[model samples]
Target: MLTQTRNVEEKLYFNRFVVDAGRPHITVRPHERPSAELRSLTHMCPAGCYSQNEAGQVEIATDGCLECGTCRIVTARTGEVEWNYPRGGFGILYKFG
Candidate 1:
């Protein structure tokens, strides 16, 4: 049998929502994605999605995620990570979402 692997062992030095990818060639990598351009996005997650991660940073994810610069540009700079995006062609297929 073949051995396993490590995909995205660390998202940030802290505040990790995903970890231990447990398989080689599984197509995983740390992605610092660009923020969305949808202007409708406004409020941050008051429910605390960031606290759920390994670290206590939660300014990202798909809740009321406004696609504004809430999580990526600003939150990332302050080091209060709380986000993850769906794989391309997957997750919420928003025709108008």
Candidate 2:
């Protein structure tokens, strides 16, 4: 079987991208609270958008998000992650296309 040839973020770094500043499309509830279910999103998000802050709070940096919906799917059980698509013309854009 083939291994993960490259780190997820490393690969996403090569693609063209755009980030909106106003509001994040993805958000975590109970800002200071921690959840085992949501914590796993840090490893599952392909773009490495989900992570824990120094305070141990779940942080969702949507800029690099690949919009893969993996985070939404993983956190669906708890309904704590607010997931939605970015407004039109926002978020990632592939350069080659």
Candidate 3:
């Protein structure tokens, strides 16, 4: 019998981010309608991935935003999110994910 040798030191990519339903308020309201128009019309949509700021402005989730760049371009008044730096340099690192 022989054991296979492998490199122990390496940077591994962990994809498949588990999107939590979060609290009841975080999840889509029961009466909410899933609309394609809404997805296209807003930077963050009513889906509320990145929450709104104190002034009712959307806060950017650039780190895990999938880089759609919609946060800056979307003309929606409520969904204009600002970017946040990667916390402690630990954030979403896309590696073919």
Each model's TM-score, in the order given?
A: 0.28, 0.77, 0.30
lDDT of 2 by residue, 1-97 (tens): 8765666556656776667787889888875676787888888777788888888888887877778888788877888899899889888875423
Which candidate model has the greater lDDT, 2 or 3?
A: 2
**Candidate 3 per-residue C-alpha lDDT over 19-90 given as tens digits, one digit per residue, 9 for 90 to 100:** 223211111112233233223433443222554445543332222334343543553353323433333334
Q: Among all windows of ten consecutive residues in candidate 2, which has the lowest summed lDDT?
A: 4-13
Candidate 1, residues 1-97, lDDT tens digits: the string is 9975434323212221222233211111233432332111223433222322243222233432223334445444433334455444333222222
RMSD in angstroms, all models?
16.2, 5.0, 11.3
Ranking by lDDT: 2, 3, 1
Model 1 clashing-pair count = 7
Which number leads on TM-score?
2
Task: Give the better candidate number (1 or 3) by lDDT.
Answer: 3
Which ranges in model 2 have alpha carbons more than 4 Å from their true place?
1-11, 95-97
Off by over 4 Å in 1: 1-69, 82-84
How close to the true structure is residue 45 of candidate 3, measured as C-alpha lDDT? 37
**Ten-residue region with minimum lDDT total, candidate 3:** 22-31
